[model samples]
Target: MSTPLIPLTLLLILTAVLVESQSIIPIRYDGFVYKKRAASTGTVLIEAFYDPVCPDSRDSWAPLKQAVDYYGTNVVSLIVHTFPLPYHDNAFVTSRALHIVNDLNVSATYHLLDAFFKHQEQFYNAQTLGMSREAVLDQVIGFASSTLGNSFKSAIKSGFNDSKTGTKTRVSFKYGCSRGVYGTPFFFVNGFLVPFNDDDTIDYNGWRKLIDPLITKKQHYPSNIF
Candidate 1:
């Protein structure tokens, strides 16, 4: 009798075969999914992939703020993807908490970003070097509860634990990977990542150089959000 053509036969054959190949994957520029700020006009969109706990990001916040003010609504700013590394304890929780604020549509997200910069040490004990995840969540939820209603607390918790969060995290990681980002404070302007260096003393100058030309050319003007 012929051996039965069972599932094992197909499985064995497939296991033996090896697939190897490399393809030129298209690099997804920022414009693929991101949109300009509502008030933006004749202006460029700036996507800043940053981690709240990153010192480099904190240090650059001053200049970033200045730049935003200088350009006003001429430039759209977006903070995407908070990657909390293993070395930085509770960093993930901090990010998760912030995501909660964002999901809740609480303006606190931006305020929290500023707070995180100034009081990161409080949240992250230098000696202990990490805040309790639950504690941080409490702080975020408590602040949001007053205006957003208590539902925000539960929703944040849900979103934080939801599968969508992971998906968004991966998308952010993929975008960063495509842009050759190995660190935080990664900035992208007009669908292209800005090439800059740490302590390059050109943070403001570089931004001005790249954007001024475009603004002058009438590629971008300025507008206000109503």
Candidate 2:
């Protein structure tokens, strides 16, 4: 005997349930835990995939920080993902160093990143400065040590090669690749890729234009704020 067919509405409900389950499921990967500047409830989420050694990434830093400061954590959040491009000889080491710092002190990660960008010329421009890659790496590490302290330096020396660090760095690269990130300083807003112009300048106002409306519409102000 033939079995009775299920109702179409029930099939539709099952399909919807399956789709929702898949959507809510998180993507899990080994290595470094992903970090975010704000809680997931924020209306605006900015995902930045950047390489420390990239000039464009360095240039965008100030404007990005400004946006974070302006919105704070209530309306906006920033998730930083490291994407160390191959040509930047010292990028991987810097990325690894940043990962180590994140483990030790999450707050210091951005400070070290600022240090790297501020002195990119000194370290990344090795050929121009007549310095070797090893020298550049040492300089970067030294900057981290000086800015963060002895423990950071010791961690770098000891844990730079730790499998966990390596795994985190690799996972970052892979995550970027999966997201169609081919270059440094890639930006995504609320899961939508923000189109950047073909120029070195970062348009902070332009970003504000995109972000402000979303905040006005969906973000509820904290009860304490008058």
Candidate 3:
């Protein structure tokens, strides 16, 4: 009997293939940027690919936020790309929810992102094992309502069910794949994938060591950036 066909994406993941980016012409930082800043302002452009429900992503979130706050938006601007691991049953929906939240409100998206990373366990595989996709989404919508308010619920629900949201979310995933990201919490700084710091745990100080050097004397970071 002929072996069943495996989807290309699954095969790529299984083999740990490095997919080439779709464009050689520098892909734009299209992800949802936090604390947007002007490019010429010499900001540390940070891009991260996070699987919305992944524990590692959750664990890494706080320090990442702290580092950004430490440098302040003047020195750092963060962008998020959700790369939902297909093995995580509800990962896609949660990733899509971020897209929905971003579309509705750029400012609110990060709050929702912060909330998702904070309460991600509520939507984990074990928690949602026997749940229907729609049911889990309802839970997510309710969670958004609590975090983002009741007025956001209907719009969020509609966006969740909309094809456009799914498409945009898929784009995020594909972009991550194209960037050779097979894992959650993969990061890039100034368009290059950042090597993990040797610290037992990364923190604001760890980030300073990584970012400070990038800022040249001419560019110079914020007054209190030290």
Candidate 4:
């Protein structure tokens, strides 16, 4: 007898349920949270806090690169600095180099990152990469001048020296501290810090296990950004 009214009531209840779900289900990529670039819509964010002068960090570079390449658009690699040791004098310089390259709005930042790691042994020694202060600046100048230009080279050097004014370095450090990063090679998946030293070795398998799921579940659609 009241079938029409019952249908109407059910429709109203369903609408309310849908509205509540929309409000409660958190959207991940709204904006750049914590100064780290937001992941693309429906994608995962990987915030890596690494030190260029850290031996362990260097060892992780290969696997990290592979993961980034495999994930492609599904992952955003937000690299930050957690420079801990004082003996790694060139660490700050290297960080500034990446920061400057990033400023250029080109992919050269990734290139230099891999290049630096590839040649890490050549620069670093048994006593922390054996890099003298003068040589460190020179290496930066040589790399930037050859690939980018003299202006960029100078900017990199200036950025490294004036830590007081280097916004990028400050931002990186801030991101690290905010995430409770105490050392190099710390990896965060989707804003969550990964547990470390469980197996007494930070190997490629461990990183892949943490990251592969995020990559597989990510979805992408065409964007209007230009």
lDDT of all predictions: 0.55, 0.71, 0.77, 0.57
Collision pairs in model 1: 42-220, 42-221
1-226, model 2: which lDDT tens digit per residue?
A: 0112447874575455455444342245322222344446545778888788888888887888787778765667777888887667778888888888887777788888888888777556454367766776677678789988866787776667588877677667766666656677888888788876646555689778888888886745674554
Query: Against the correct fold, how does model 2 do in TM-score?
Result: 0.76
| TM-score-best of 2 and 3 | 3
Candidate 3 lDDT by residue in tens digits, 92-172: 988888889888998898898888888889988899888987799899899988999999999999997799889777778
User: Which scores better on lDDT, 2 or 3?
Assistant: 3
User: Residue 197 CA error for candidate 3 (Å)?
Assistant: 7.8
**Mind giving the per-residue lDDT tens digits that candidate 1 earns over 1-226?**
1112337764453333211101222233322112234434345666676666777777766766666567755444444556554355556666666665665564556666677767666445463335465666666556445445576677766776787654454445445555545466677776687766555433666666777777665543433533
Tens digits of per-residue lDDT for model 4, 166-203: 55554555445445554667776666777766224346
**Pairs clashing within candidate 3:** none
RMSD of 3: 6.5
Residue 100, candidate 4: C-alpha displacement in angstroms: 1.5
